[model samples]
Target: MDPSTLLITFLFFLAALLYASVGHGGASAYLAVMALLGVTPAEMRPTALILNILVAGVGTFKYIRAGRFSWSVFWPFALTSVPMAYLGGRIHLPVRYFELLLGVALLFAALRLLIKPGGEREGLHPFALGWALGIGAVLGFVSGLIGIGGGIFLSPILIFLGWAETRQVSGIAAAFIVVNSASGLFGLLQSHPPLPAAIPFWMVAVLAGGWIGAELGSRYLTAPWIRRALGVVLVVAALRVLVV
Candidate 1:
């Protein structure tokens, strides 16, 4: 690989590490990096979603093995998200619209990363089925449309609503990302978008990073500063997408 490609791969690894450490799929960061690197719009969504599946899949397994998962807290949201995400994936937007929406999504993801959620209190609230399903539908559709896994949006909302604790949220988010990314990818397959030849190399890089990060996070490590720094990068990339 050339220097630029090598650097992008390294960034993908770093994005996976940082995101999976907190139970995320790193799609938003991947999208941001691709945008900043001038990757074609057609390639960005599939690439990010593919990487998300591997990274988030690792995180899901690690978090579940660590006993951080909650079925009650996870299912209601996922029940609705999967199908909607698939539907959204099948609907391709024009290039200008895609860039605009992706820029907005990146900004939202940046905000979530920049402002870390507060420590969980002792009392955790019960998951509200109606609210979760509705929110899941919205997030799922957006995830499919924008080529993300939707975990970035889900984590904060769950935390803010007190539906799940930090560790539980991580587990739930990881699983959610896996399913959504997979569903979105399957839906995207209808069009059979061309994937980059280097995808295998990138997937391996992210898988390694995701494994290491998820191991540390599920055990007892949270890298807030790293997340915040990455959030900064996302913001710059989002602006680039919007303006340039």
Candidate 2:
């Protein structure tokens, strides 16, 4: 219909490619896109969460099949995150607050990930259920409140705590994002809020991008490329949230 809609869809495609490559679902980036177009704030969270599910679902399957997944590593964080994310999604914020928080979150993630890559070999750190649960709950709630999948927050913590190597972190983040998005979407649906009608169009774009990007990142692309692409996505997300 509208030319702008096509542009936004294209942008979503590219964002999904970059974000899914690094194990993200690109909700923050989607929110940024919606913001720039002056899409209704009330609609943004539900819409973004829906898109997050599709892309993260693809990413999760791809990474897990590539042998990057660890159920033991995933369950602890997911245990608390799912419910907490649901709780957060149920509470609605004012439009301005949502925009501000999304921008700040994107900026923080961009800066955190811009640091040099860590150890090449996977770290053999012991799984700490307590730490994972605590971190998961916090990020999940925040993700729900702000309309994200929380992978950006979780992956960095995993790397910092030496729980997983870079690629492993990507896989974990992909799975984590999928569940959180599902939970958040469930919560949002309860409110009878409207989701964008363009969802079907957007979903196809993201799924295709997610498949291609996740495949390349998991099998062909090196760690450095994934990291760089993630950085670019985060920076663009930050700018979109702030300026739009």
Candidate 3:
């Protein structure tokens, strides 16, 4: 393979490793990389969603198997999110608008990574189902619109509200990413655009990285430094998108 393709493959693996460790699907990071590579917005969205599915799928299985997941914490949000994500995927934006919005999204993800929140509170707060549903709907729509799985936003919300523990948040976020990404991809497929030919190689790289990261995360691995490093990369990519 060419050097550029090899570099992209390696970056994809690294993104998956860091994100899956935190129960994310790495869609934002993938988008940032593509943005740096000068990929069109139309290609970026579906490609990111496809990668999100593979990586987050691994995280979901690992976190659930490790008993970090809570059904009560997961289902209410997912119920509203699925349909909203599908709806959002069906609506296409102008290329300029999409790039602008995606740049903002990359910045947000970078911010989330840089500002590491404290661990779960001693006493978990009771979740408000109504609030969760509303937030989920909004996030889901944004996910489909921006090609993210929404875990980047959801994790912090849960932490700020003290609704779930850190591990629980990770597990729930992973599962949430999976469903939303899958729903978004399904919606995108209706337009019948061909995916990038290199998707299979990217998928294998992400899966390998995702598995190792999930294994470490589910057991006992804290990666604040890794997150911060990735955050810096996202900031650069976001700047690239906004400037060019």
Q: Highest TM-score: which candidate?
A: 2
In angstroms, how far off is 170's CA in candidate 3? 0.6
> What tens-digit string does per-residue lDDT give for candidate 2 at 48-95?
998899998998899989987778888899999999999999987665
lDDT of each: 0.83, 0.84, 0.81
- Over 4 Å off in model 1, which ranges? 94-119, 222-244
What value does the lDDT take at residue 93 in candidate 1?
73
TM for candidate 3 is: 0.86
Which is the leading candidate under lDDT?
Answer: 2
Candidate 3: where are CA atoms >4 Å away?
95-123, 222-244
Against the true structure, candidate 2 has what lDDT? 0.84
Q: What tens-digit string does per-residue lDDT give for candidate 3 at 13-57? A: 998988888888888778878777766766888989999999999
Clashes of 2: 0
For all predicted structures, in order, the TM-scores are 0.85, 0.91, 0.86
What lDDT tens digits, residue by residue, belong to model 1 across residues 1-244?
8776787899999989888887888887788787778778888889999999999999999999999889988898899999999998998876566668767976887887677577534236766799999999998998898788888778767765778767777889999999999999899988988887778889999999999989878896653543564466457556755876
